[model samples]
Target: MRVPVLNPNYLLTSVLFVLFGSFDCSELDMDGEISLRLEHSLDMGKSWQDRGSLSFSKARSAIPTVNQGPLSDENLSTLENLCSKNMFYLIKVTGDGIGELQSYTPACTMLDSSLAEQITLFLDWRGNPVAANLASRIGVVGHKVTAGKFDTRVQIQSMENGPTPDTAAYIQKMEEEKSRKMSGEKPDNRSFFAKYWMYIVPLCFILLINSAGAPENGGR
Candidate 1:
C-alpha cells in the first residue's frame, strides 16, 4: 500500500484563514461607556483655542441622578451658556434643588503647558495625587462642584470665560463608528481556489496519474 502526499498549498491557505479570523474577535467581553470629546478655546472673540477636551460619555452614564424640582429655562440656559462660552468661569451645578457655585481661571494661551497641566489636574482630582497641585492652581475645588439626580447634564462654565462650541453632534457620529464591527457581513468568496478550482483539480488528477505511472519505488 502507498500513502498519498497532501498538497502543500492547501495546507498553507487553511492556516492563514484561521489565524486572521481569530485576531478579529479577540476583545468581545468588556463593556464601558463611550467617551465623547469636548474641546474649546479660551479667547472669546478671536480664533478659538484648543484648551483641552474631555470624554463625558462614560461619566454621563455612570453618575446617578436625583429627582430635583422642575428645571427652569433659566437654569437650562445657564448650563448651555457655560458650555458654549469661551471665557474662564466656574460652574456650580446643583443637584435636587441644592447646588453650590465656585469660580476658577481660564486658559490664557492654548499652547501653555502649565495651563494644560492645571486643566488636567482639575479634571482628575477625583482620581490621583499629582492632580491636586494642578487643580489648586486652576482654582478648581473638587468637592464644591455638585450635581442633582435629574442634573445628568454637564456644565462647563469658564472662570475667565471665552467661546466654546457644542461639538456633541460630531462626537456622537464618531462613537457610532467605533462601536460597529464587521461581523455578519459577507465574506470574500473569490480566491485562487474559487476562480480556478475546476482547472486546477483536473490538473491535479493528471499529476497524480503521471506520478503513479512513473515507477513503484524503482521496483517491478
Candidate 2:
C-alpha cells in the first residue's frame, strides 16, 4: 500500500500551534484610582489655584468643573510675568493625591491670547494619570486623548496600557470561519480519468504518434 507523504512545513506549523496552545495565556486584573488635579500659578509660582479635580477609574469617571470665574488678577499677573520671561506656565497634576505630582508645561504662553484652550489627560494601565507630554518608563501609555478645556478637561485615555486583545473571541471567530469553510466545501465527484485527462491525453497522443511513425514490427 502507498503511504501518504507528510509536508515538512505543515509539521512545523502544527508543532508551533501546540507549543503556543500549551502556554497559559491569561489576562491580569489590574485596577487603581485615577484622580487628577491641576495646580496653576497665577503669580509666577508665588501663589496658585487648586482647580477642581477629576477622577477616572473603573468605579467612576469624572469631568472637569467650570472655573468659578475667569482668571483672577493674581492669576493673570503670574501668567504675564512668566510670559515676559518666555517661559511656559507650569501645571501640577496630583495623581490620587499621592506620590510625586506630575508637571504639565504647555508650550503656549500663559496669556489667554496665547494659551491653548484645550488639553488631554492620559491614563496608564494601572488606571493612574501620567504626564501627557513626558516620556513614560513603561512606554506609550494612552488609548485616546480626552478633549477638554486646558483648565477643565479631564478626559481619560489609555495608551499601551490598554486592555489585552480578546484572544478567546478571536480564536472562536477563526474556528467558526474554519468550520464554515470546511462545511461549505464540495466533494470531488469526478472520475479518475476526468481528473487527470490533460496529462493522460497528452501522453496517449505522444504514444500513438510514435507508434504510427515507427517501422512495422520486424519480420519474426
Candidate 3:
C-alpha cells in the first residue's frame, strides 16, 4: 500500500497521539487518576456495551478545549493496541470531582497509517456547560499528554446526517474550509499522488487484475 503522511488538518501531537478539538469539547481534571471506560456500539448508539477501562496515571481531560492545544500522547501506543476495533467507540471518563465526561466518539485503529484520513470531532450534544465546568475542575496539567505536534482543526461529520448545533456548526465549518482550499485561501502543499496513490494503485494492480484474469479455477 502506498503510505501517506498524516493529514495536514489532522494533528498528531506526538508520533503516538492524534488529537481533535472543537467548540463543544471534554472536561479535564487536575487531581487524582481518571478512569477511562470504553463503550462499544456496533449499530451506532442504539446499543452500547461496556468494553473496558483505560486508566491514566494521573488526571487529564479526555477532550481538548479551546485553550487546550493539541492533546499530548500519554499512552497512545497502548491505546492503539487496546482500542483497535472497527465498531464505533464512545470514550467515557469518570473520576473524583468529575462524574463522567463522555469524551471521544471515534472510529479508532492502530493502523490509521492506512485508514482513510479525515479530521473530525464529536461535538457537544449535551449542551451542559455545568458539566463542562464541573469537568474543568479536573485540570489537565501533568495528567494529560503534551508531547506531540499540536493540531486544533476539526470538521463536523456532515455525511452522518445528525441534527444538532455542534453538527451544524461542523458542517458549516467544513464547507468554509472546502471553499477556502478551493479559493487558495488555504494552500495544500502535499503531493496529490501521495494522498491518492494508495486508492488508485490497488485498483490497477489488484482489483482490475483480478477481474481481468481468469477466475481462481476451483480456489487454486
Ranking by lDDT: 2, 3, 1
- Arranged by TM-score with the best first, the candidates are 2, 3, 1
Per-residue lDDT of 65-183 in model 2, one digit per residue for the tens?
43423455555555566667776655555654344344435323334323333345554333444444321122223222122223333444543422223344544644665577699
Model 3: CA > 4 A from native: 1-31, 59-89, 95-97, 103-220
List residue ranges in candidate 2 displaced over 4 A. 1-33, 42-49, 59-69, 106-108, 112-116, 133-151, 161-220
lDDT of each: 0.31, 0.44, 0.33
Estimate, for each residue in 25-66, the C-alpha lDDT of model 1 and write its tens digit.
432312333232222222332333222223322232344222
Error of 2 at 44 (Å): 6.1
Native-structure RMSD, model 1? 25.4
TM-score of 1: 0.19
**Candidate 3 clash pair list:** 13-148, 13-149, 14-148, 28-138, 29-138, 29-139, 30-138, 30-139, 72-145, 72-146
Over 75-154, each residue of candidate 3 has an lDDT whose tens digit, in order, gives: 34433434465433333333444454443333342123212122232222221111210011122223322243222222
Best by lDDT: 2
Q: Indicate the residue-level lDDT of 18 in model 2.
A: 52
